[model samples]
Target: MKRTIPLAIVLTMGITMMVQFFVPHPVSVGYYDLTTRWIRIVGAFALVLGTGSFIMFHSDKVRRRRQGWYYSIISLVALVVTTVIGLGWGIRPGSILQNVIYANFLVPLNASMFAILAFYMASAAYRAFRARTKEAALLLIAAFIVMLGMVPIGASIWGKLPELAEWVLSVPNMAAKRAIIFGVALGGIATSLKVILGIERGWLGGGKQ
Candidate 1:
């Protein structure tokens, strides 16, 4: 009984949503709009649940004198400050204090996070690149080619290197990204259907029907 209820909702909503794509009627369009709204509501509720969980976890860490209590304090302070500022004064980029927050806090923090990726990439290259075996040697060669191809030095030395880099990035890279994106889009539609029909009860946590 427990499984059957959710399964039935999933089947009903999934079929209706798929059919709505073909149907061109007022009723079908209405159903689609209603389902979309329900999905949005569920998403908002999920955010609330997530925020509550985050606060509870951090509060417990702070209470227990955890090693990362300082980070917890910082996170809570940032959240409260941001919320109060946004609510009290409009969150406009033109606002001096908001601009200060963005300049001093958000821009520096996010930019630094991304800047660390270069160091991480260097470390990874050091560890991974070894001309040990046939496949490893081929990979090392390809990595070196791609890395150097992006720089003016290699492209200047070998004129075709930049062309090869462009082909790899535009063709194979785009194809792989498109495949992943298609799969993600399908998954999102399926999940939205399940949520609207209340089939994904785990989002609400298990409880008595």
Candidate 2:
């Protein structure tokens, strides 16, 4: 009975949403709007649940004197500070304090995090590009060709290198990426339909235990 009720709710909401997209009739539109607003309220509750879980997990680690307690403390402080500042003084983009916090802290932190990816990429490339097989050798050659194409000096020496890079990037690379993206899109649509149909009931704790 519990499973049946939730399944009915999901099917009703989901089908109404899809039909609203295509039909746009008054009844369908009203039903869609009502369901969307209810979903937003549920979403707010979900956010509270997420934040409460974050606090509980970190607080538990702090209480246990975990290896990275200091980092957790830093995170908690940052969260509290941001919440208080935004709530107390508002978070308008042009506000002096908001601009200062973003320019001084957020921008540099984001840049540094992105820069760390360079080291990981270097380590992975070292492991990946060993000339152990014909395929690996071919990939190494392509990588060097692409790297050379990016630099003015190498491009000047080999006039066709830049053209080769352009072809690689525009043709095969884009085709492969598009194929993978289309597959992912189809998979996502299938999963979403399953969820709406209540076949994917693990999301609701296997239909209320």
Candidate 3:
């Protein structure tokens, strides 16, 4: 009964949304506006659910004194502080709480994470660019040229290297990127259709129905 009710709702909403896309009538537009409002309300409820789950999960880790429990404590404290500030002060720019938590705490933390990620990317790039084969050698040369082309030293050595890099980026790189994006879009459409058709039931917390 529980599964059936949710599936019915999903099917109805999915079909309705699809039909509205083809219909340009005022009623269809009204449905679009109404659904957006419902989306916000549903999203608010989801945030409350997610926050509760996060707090409970971290609190349980802290209670059990698990490895890295100290980090869990920090997570909970940060969550509480951020939530309280957002609710109390409305998170307006230049607010004291926003400045302290977002500017002082989050900005530096995010920067440090990305800074570490840059090192990992460099290591991975070094591994990939190792000239083990013809393809790898070509990749290494292209990457080196591109890197050199971005700086003043390349201009001193070969002023045309930058133009070659620009051509490579605009042509081959963009072509590959567009192909990847097209494949990803097709995959997304497939998944969306499967969900709308109820072929994918994973989101309802179980395997396919």
Candidate 4:
């Protein structure tokens, strides 16, 4: 009964939303806006669920004294401290502690993480861009042109390199990006249809056998 009710709700909402997209009536627009608000309410509830799950997992690890439990403690402390600060004092820029913590600690930490990510990406790129295959060679060439086109040195070497690179990006790259987006949209529509029609019941839980 529980599963059936949720499935029916999903099917009805999904079909209505799809229909509203095609119908330009004021009534349809109102319904679409209503659905969007409902979505935000559901998202708030989901965030609470997610935070609870995160805390529970980390707490369990800390209690069990698992490997690297110190890190779990640090994570929990950070989460709690941040949440308290945001809630207690509205995160207005002029708020002293909030602004200080965010600007000095969080911003630097985020930037450092991104810097570390760049090194990892560089390592991965080295492996992936190696000209071991024809496809890899083409990728390497495209990457080289793109990187060179962004800088002044390439123009010094060949005045046309930048123009050629811009054309490559606008022409082939743009077309390929559009093709991928269309493919993804079609795949999403297919998957959503399957779910609404009850063919994708894996979301219901283990009793689906």
Could you give the candidate ranking by TM-score, starting with the highest? 4, 3, 2, 1
Candidate 3 lDDT tens digits, 49-109: 8888998999999999999999999899887878788888886788867788778988999
User: All candidates' TM-scores?
Assistant: 0.74, 0.81, 0.86, 0.90
Candidate 3 regions with alpha-carbon error over 4 angstroms: 122-128, 151-153, 207-209
**Tens digits of lDDT, candidate 4, 69-101:** 999999999998888887888877787456678
Show pairs that collide, candidate 4. Answer: none
The positional error of residue 125 in candidate 2, measured at the CA in angstroms, is: 2.6
Per-residue CA lDDT of model 1 for 95-168, tens digit only, reads 64468777788899999999999999899878976788998887676667778889999778899998887777
Ten-residue region with minimum lDDT total, candidate 1:
200-209
lDDT by residue for model 2 (84-116), tens: 777788878776446877788889999999999
lDDT of 4 at 166: 98
Cα deviation at 206, candidate 1, in Å, is 6.1
With candidate 2 superimposed using the best TM-score fit, by how many Å does residue 62's alpha carbon deviate from the native?
1.9
TM-score quality measure for candidate 1: 0.74
